[model samples]
Each structure stands twice: as structure tokens, then as C-alpha cells.
Target: MIKFNTKTNQRSDYLPAASYSLVKQINSRGVYSFCMCPGGVIAPCATKNNEIVTNGWSPSQRNYPTANSGIVIELKVDDFKKYSSFGPLAGVEFQKNIEQKAYKLSNDSQRAPAQKLLDFMNNKLSRNIPKTSYIPGTVFY
Candidate 1:
């Protein structure tokens, strides 16, 4: 999930809601925006204990400062082949594993691991996180 800086021109206060899809390279995986929520919050949507999943949603007024969305990559069946031992549920198992990993990484709590966009691209941890809509809070990781 990504949150736009409302302090800037990217704020949802003026821009209309939008979504995007892009392929960075030929024959490579495509990334697309999902659940684009203008002036929305990042919700914890985990369905099981010891796991972490996220979704996005906007309030009725869509008046929050930041906009957020799920920037998802197109996944193929082959991506879960490593978990084929799970049979027909390989994909589910794969997703579960990821969620569990996130849970573990965040010290086994509801707090989500997060970092600033620029810091992430620079392969470094953020010194501090700005205000966000995620209510359970965040831990830089």
C-alpha cells in the first residue's frame, strides 16, 4: 500500500480519484493499482491470528488528508509452485506465508512494518514516519 503526501499537491483534496497499471519491462510482470481510496485509510484486514493483511477504504466524505491504494503485482500460478506441496491450496498457503512473515517481522503484533517511500527506494530505514491513517500504528522495518 502507498499513501500520498497530503501536504503536497498530490493531496486528494483537489485531485480526482485515479488508478494506474504499468509494466516496467517487456514480458515482465505488470503492476496495477487496486482499491484506490482517495482520502482513505490503510485497514488491517487479517482474517487469522499471527498474520497481517491490509486493505484500503475511504470515509463517506473522502475528506482525509492522504490518499492510499494497493499497488499489486500480477501474480502467476507458477509463483506458488514452490508451495505446490499444499496441493490445490498452494496459492492460499503462499499468501498465508507472506502474511505470517509480516507478522513475525513486526515483532508478532498488530503494528505494521513501514518505511518512507524515498527511504525504501534508497534501501534504508526511515528516521521517522509521518502521520498516517493506519490506526494500529507502524514500526519502521
Candidate 2:
């Protein structure tokens, strides 16, 4: 099945503006790309307790149909203020809230919420979900 990751409307090019720019030491958190898997498959990342996370993996031969990666975004300490009741453990609470919400949306199972790329872009529900590599299954949104 085809998949598109980003929600942006702009088209992409082999070469684009700002393609060779880098800014450093700005005292602001930056996003980094990591957890890349080449020729891999998406995997269900969930606890037995029912939290939905998406991860990816490849076989020992690295011969899967797709690739996946994680874009890590740095969160400053100040960003945890909304979760301050738990104090320094706010980040944990924040993550828990996300997992809990996902479980609630996915019928309290390990299944993760999903939508077809076109339906997502059109802001409508997908009448049919394409086959996925994930084994835990998906709950279409």
C-alpha cells in the first residue's frame, strides 16, 4: 500500500529552497531525525496494558518492502508546565496521557488509530483501510 507521512500541502522536489541551510546554537530546541529503518516494516509498539505506539523493524537481511524513521523533537523543561502536577515526572504523565487517549480511540486494544492518506488529506473517514505490515491491526479513525 502507498503511504504519505506528512500533513503539509506543499509539493516536494528533488531540489528545493532552503535545502542546504543549517542553524546552530540558537538556544531553542530543534528536531532531529532518527530511528531510521531501511527496507523495513512498521511494527505495533504497544504495552500489554494497551498503549499505542508505532515502531519499525527489519529482518536480519534488511529486506522489507518499506522504510520508517522517527523524527525526534526536543521538548524544553518549560514545555512540561501543562503537566506540572506530577512535577519532574510530568513528561511521564504527558506520555501516559497520549497512550491512554490512543487506547481509548482504538477500542481499548493494542490496535492503533489509522486513516488512509487521501482520506486524511480530504478530512474524511476511510471507508476501506488498505493492508498494513503492522500485525496488531489498526482501528480506522
Candidate 3:
């Protein structure tokens, strides 16, 4: 998931809220954006203990100062082959593993692990992270 500070962009304040969908192929993998929300907040949506998952949503008025979205990569069954021993539940196990790992990375808290967009693209750790709409907060990683 990614988010941008809408408060810095004056145009976003007067324009109607919008959502976007983007699809592309990179390194033979399908990458796409899902549940894009203008003037939205990143929300925690974990369904189990020792795990973390996130989603985004906007209020009816969409007046928040941030916009966020989930960028997902399409996964094929082969992607979860490591958990194939679980049969049909392999994908579930794979997803659980990722969520649990994220939880651990965030110091076993609700705070999500995060890196600035530029730092991430540059493959470096962010020296600081700006404020975000995530209620539980975020920890630069």
C-alpha cells in the first residue's frame, strides 16, 4: 500500500475525490492497484492475532488530507507451492505467513512497517517519515 499527502497539493482540496486502477506487467508478474481511495486513510484489517493486514477507505465527504491505495501483485497458485503440503489451504498459509512477518517487523504492534516512497524506490531506509492517516501509526523500516 502507498499514501500521499493531499494537504500539500492544493488542487486535491477543491477537486472531487477519485479512485484509480492501474495494471501492468513487470518481470512477468502482474502488478495492479486495488481499492484506491482519494482523501482516504490506511486502516488496519487484521483478522487474527500475531498478524497485520491493511486496507484503505475514505469518508463520505472524502475530506481527509491523505490518499492511499493497495498495490497488489497477482499471485499464481505456483507462488504458494512452498505451502503445498497444506493442500487447498496453501494460499491461506502463505498469506498468513506474510501477515505474521509484517507484524513481527512492526515490533509486534498495530503500527505498520513503512518506508518513504522515494526511499523505497531508491532502496534505502527513510531518515524520517511524514505524518500519516493511519490511526495506529507507522514505523519506518
Candidate 4:
């Protein structure tokens, strides 16, 4: 991102550069009319907390049925405002590493370590399986 310090951080206030009308509505009017801005337009976007933050939407228009929705990656201060010593790219680096880790962890290769009831019964626990990351209650290991 362009690293905004404030709404007035003024990379010019209006994107698309050539357009000033949007800037007039947003900056001059002071009423940020974000169109159906995701979920709440603004939620607790916490990247440092190892949370998969997100939001969603459904329209009231013809193709819009009011419905439910769904929702990454690690990000640290060092990788953001610190490491790489490159300002915003630090955050990019952090996200890259987190994505890599997530991909590696999720590579089940169509054969996760699940066992049938008979197999589970036949085996005794000599090593501990990891705690499942699934929500609700994870199955017993």
C-alpha cells in the first residue's frame, strides 16, 4: 500500500490522479462515502496479531441476496516499519514469509495423517500429533 499516516496524508487525496471530483467528495466533504465498504467499511485490521482479518458483502440489487460471508499471513513490526529497512516493503516481506509457512503447513498432498477407526485403535500414541487448528472442538488426537 501507499502507507497512509492520515486521511490527509495526501498522495493527493484522490486516486486515479486525473480525477479531482472524488477527492472533493472525500476530502472536502469529510464524509467518507465508501460504497458498500466491506463488512463494516472499517474493522479491527490487526496484522500484528496473527489474525486472518477480512470482511465481505452482499448487495440489495437484483443479483443481490442478503447472505452470509467469509474471511492471512503473518506481519510484524520489523517486517513492516523496521526490517528490510525499506519502509512499507518490510510489511510485504513479513506477509511473504507468513504465506510461505501457511502453504508448507497446508500441503497435505491428498493424504493427511488421518486414520480409519481400526487403524487408530491398532496404534498406540508414541508421538503426539499437533493440536488441530480447526475451530469448535478439534477431534481428539
Candidate 5:
């Protein structure tokens, strides 16, 4: 019954009509404002694969559009239920696993698999583990 057209009607490149108008109003000669940090400090946001990363920018200083691209894979309703073991908290669960694995391989209790400066220089794992990123939420850990 559903036609499922392959064609898409995407109108937004990023900003909407009203947002563009606001920037037009403020681009004056004496504005003298640069290095404009919009929502400074990166946040630990994840993509579909759950690789945590941060994003932020400085205007005038960076001298470019405050934009960062993300690689996202599309999924359907069936995709949501794909991971049979992770019935509900799939994303959170996956992060915990990463931390735990990284933790056991880590030196300190923080739970992030880490190597020492000398170990890194020697290209070896340190016998004395240093630190980890695993927080209190790792129930399985």
C-alpha cells in the first residue's frame, strides 16, 4: 500500500529562513567581534556507532562557518531491534562495554585503557596500569 518514494524533499541545508535573516541584520562593519565561541566546550555526543567525541568552534579566530560534519548511518524500525542482546539500553550498554574493555587494559581505577609515556615510547603495555574512564555506571564491570 505504501509507495516508498526514493526521492526525498530536503529543503534545509542547515539554517531555516528566519535564522538567515537574523545573521543578515547583525553583520555590521563596527561589530568588531571575532573568535565568537558559540556554545564553547565540546560535548561527549555519539553517532550511530557510539564513538564518543566533542565539537565546538571559535568565530573570527577560526574564520569559517561554525560547522562540523558527522558520519551517520540510517536505520529503520527493524534496525532499532536488531541487537537481540541489547533489548533496551543498547547504546548505553555498548559504551559500558567499551569502557570495561578499556578499563581492564588500563592501569588506574578510572577505567580507561591507558599506557604510560615510557610504554608508549617503547611501544609496549605498562605493567603498572595508570587510569581508566569507566564510571560508577558500569554494572557489568
Candidate 6:
């Protein structure tokens, strides 16, 4: 995994549990992994209303071949300068836009946009994507 951090603190010996309790406030953004599923499969996380979101969960034994984590980046008031006119609702608007854009880019389907790991880092699109654990599947974009 590609870890990005400049911290020198060693991680706790305890097995990391739910991320809901952990909050990292940086640049007015609450950065945390939403659901951490070790040895789990990525699930189709769209709501009944037809919005695309991704989530993962593992069995108690965590014996699956794959593991996934949903990292969430929350925007704070300062990050909504362009939408300051919306006041407190700016963040909501921004999130809605992101979901809508993802739906549109994926041809209004449940398929999620995906790219090769190396291709993504090199800023290039892969001609083909490897198989994924995502059930709804992914469309290389």
C-alpha cells in the first residue's frame, strides 16, 4: 500500500477498529477511513435512491482474500470559500456535486470509475483494468 504521512509517532499496538472514533483535523478537513474491513470484499454502497457510494465490511474471522477501506475527506467551512454564499450548506452542496459527477461519468450506472494503480500514479489511463473485488464492478475511466 502507498502510505503518505510525515508523522514520526509509532502506531498503537491495539488493532485499529472503527474509524468513526478517530478524527484528524487538518486544513479544516476531517480525514479518516470510514469503514476498515480487513480481509473483506468491496460492496456496492449505493443507496436505494440510486446514488453511488462505496463501503466495505469483513466477517468476524476476516478470512477473505481481500481487504478494503473507505477513506473520507470532509470539507470544512474554510474550504467552501467559493460557496460561501450557501453559508453552512456549502459542504452539502459540494458533496452532492461529487456524487452527481461520479454518476454522470460512469454512464449513470452503478459501475464505479477505476484505474490501474500504476497508471493512476503516472497520470495516465490504463487500456485495461485488472479484476477488482468491487461487486458492482468498475469501468476504467
Give the whole-model CA lDDT for all candidates, comma-separated: 0.77, 0.67, 0.80, 0.32, 0.36, 0.66
- How many Å off is the CA of 134 in candidate 6? 1.7
- Clash number for each model: 0, 0, 0, 5, 12, 0
Q: Score candidate 6 by TM-score against the native.
A: 0.63
lDDT of 1 by residue, 10-50 (tens): 53344456645543432477755476667788989999999
Model 1, global lDDT? 0.77
The TM-score values for the models, in the order shown, are: 0.75, 0.60, 0.79, 0.25, 0.24, 0.63
Give candidate 4's error at residue 136 in angstroms. Answer: 19
- Kindly report which residue pairs in candidate 4 clash with one another: 52-72, 78-83, 79-90, 79-91, 80-91
Give one digit per residue, the lDDT tens place, for model 5 in 4-82.
2336622233332121111112222122212223213223333433233333443333323233222223334454454
lDDT of 6 by residue, 38-100 (tens): 557877766544457766778765656566766566855666677777888888777666677
Model 1 segments more than 4 A misplaced:
1-16, 19-23
What C-alpha lDDT, on a 0 to 100 scale, does residue 57 get in candidate 5? 43
Output the better candidate (2/6) by lDDT: 2
| Range of the 10 consecutive residues with the lowest summed lDDT in candidate 1 | 18-27
Best by TM-score: 3
Task: Report each candidate's C-alpha RMSD, comma-separated, in the order given.
Answer: 4.6, 9.1, 4.3, 19.3, 19.6, 8.1
Candidate 3: where is the Cα deviation over 4 Å? 1-21
- Tens-digit lDDT string for candidate 4 (39-110): 122222225433333233333221221222221122335335545665657766666555444334335111
> Comparing candidate 1 with candidate 2, which one achieves the higher lDDT?
1
Indicate which candidate wins on lDDT.
3
**Residue 127's lDDT in candidate 5:** 73
- lDDT for 86 in candidate 5 is 81
What residue pairs clash in candidate 2, if any at all?
none
The parts of candidate 6 lying over 4 Å away from their true place are: 1-36, 48-50, 70-79
